[model samples]
Target: MSFFKAIRIDQRAETCDARYVDMAEEELMPGDVDLAVTHSAINYKDGLAVTGKGAVVRRFPMIPGVDLAGRVTRSTHPDFSAGDLVVATGCGVGEAHYGGFAERARLSGDWLVKLPGTLTPARAMTVGTAGLTAMFCLLALERHGLAPTDGPAVVSGASGGVGSFAVALLAAAGWRVAAITGHPAEADYLTSLGAAEILAREAFAQPGKPLQSQRFAAGVDTVGGVTLANILAQTQFDGAVAATGNVGGMDLPASVAPFILRGVALLGVESVRPRIALRRAAWARIATDLDAALIDAMCEVIPFDQALERARAIVTGKIRGRVVIEMP
Candidate 1:
């Protein structure tokens, strides 16, 4: 058939570069279904992949996008058919395989989740990997016996996509939200998303005692390193912290005092390789619990060509909430 434009990353003389080029459908990876991509969203991982900032890409000349939503154009899988709406996130889409960020995609039917009745293609991407990560974090907290009535839950890195979604989801679930942010100007924005309190990054990012005064009953931490250590230090007895992102740093300088003395739980949330059952459950919860109006207010729609710009913004913490790319 005809060639289509796709963003590709190439390696030359030990250096990596990203560019958009016209490619044939035959270049796509083997999969059971072919999709006419409608929308995709930028994630922190996507930023790393596109910018070559982290070890996000394992091969040269790759397409980078962690999440996509669209209609099926062809399928070998019995459960999926032409014209069926589908969403796929994680499952190594952008990292180990050629992914979205193109007009068409080939993906395993097993990786696909049919869009719920409550969500359209655009809205599905609006809740992309970031929102799904938020859901996974919240689910982790819930599994650890954290309840809304327990007390306030802190959301670290509150201005970013996952953090913003965490704040809104926790609030909607009837938990008081304490937003921790470096951008003081986003306090009002955090408040609008249902954060009851805004804590400055300076107040929390500093190195602190191994054990500090208990604060949150639970927490969803997107910033790792000392930020996670501090959250662990201050979490209430028997409280749980879902640790997701490592934007702050990967090394966690922490003491065992919290876990040994207070019984605090450190739950690691990895959305990329989550079990199919957990992925389905997380999406179901998101479909029912997320506030659509609030999500709309928090999301920014961008043309597909601007995905790179949006990815850079996401990596630099310049973008608020989610950035959805309209593909067609």
Candidate 2:
């Protein structure tokens, strides 16, 4: 087709507006490889962009989707070829670029990762950027020499997409996972994902001491601010915490005692710009490390038209796991 369906976000005055529109192939951003996007997924950053709640969309009149899985229809890049399945996340998609909300995508071949043999396009989107990030956190802890034998692991914001995947990935890797959530009612859901303990969010809501009791060996913290501060304070000596999202707040109301005294490490995960090799390695591991059944269970697939509505739920913390978008 000369034109494809896409969700376009444009700024009208001070407000941001997102709508479904027909976009010509010429309107796609410049790139060497062209793909017929079969699937995409929502992320917290996407929610902010779609709803205009945060400064996620740097360019106006842009398509907004951070993750996509599809097949190459044309390519000049050596690493990809026509009819090859591929997946892409981050690298500025949904922000400065046209992104994958469209039925077609023209993206840098460097930004694409060939889908692992075990992962289907739809399943890849189920894992999406959130799951990739979750795996990155685990890899960080592994590089730091922390193992399941180290001690119990804790994940803050356990009900969200990244946090939920973190819980499952950690558990599957044999870590004793303690999930921390604001929604007390999701305890059962968290447990089903392999959490060994369920902690209330209130426990970390307030400002905590510079160094508190060593309750966790390592942590995957999605919520920043007081929650991250508390996780750092409570981490065991020589333990590390990989932090990604800042949904709680950007300001870190914390002290250096955890680092100086306990030797705790705070690893900042940036999924948007990871090295291509690392991205490939992480995706490869995810395909094997995680059970396909669990991955299927962790996401809810929706039609492309419902993307914005789901985006609102994600930003407001109403989504339980991942939200996969099926392209029409």
Return the TM-score for each candidate structure.
Answer: 0.94, 0.95
Residue by residue across 1-328, what tens digits does model 1's lDDT show?
A: 8677778888778666887788899999889999988998888788888877889988877888889999999999988999899999989898888887888899999899888788888888888888889999999999888998887899999988889989988998999999999999998999998999999998878899999999989999999999999999999989999999998999999999999999999999988874878888887888888878876886789998898778867778676677889984
Root-mean-square deviation of candidate 2: 1.6
Best by lDDT: 2
RMSD in Å for model 1: 1.8
Q: Which candidate should be chosen as best, given TM-score against the real structure?
A: 2
Query: Which whole-number lDDT from 0 to 100 does residue 262 have in model 1?
Result: 97
Q: Report how far residue 258 has shifted in candidate 1, in Å.
A: 1.5
Looking at model 2, report the run of 10 residues with the lowest lDDT sum. Answer: 313-322
> Mind giving the per-residue lDDT tens digits that candidate 2 earns over 172-271?
9999999999888999889998999999999999998999999999999999999999999999999999999897999999998999999999999879
- Cα lDDT over the full model 1: 0.88
Which pairs of residues have clashing backbones in candidate 2? Answer: none
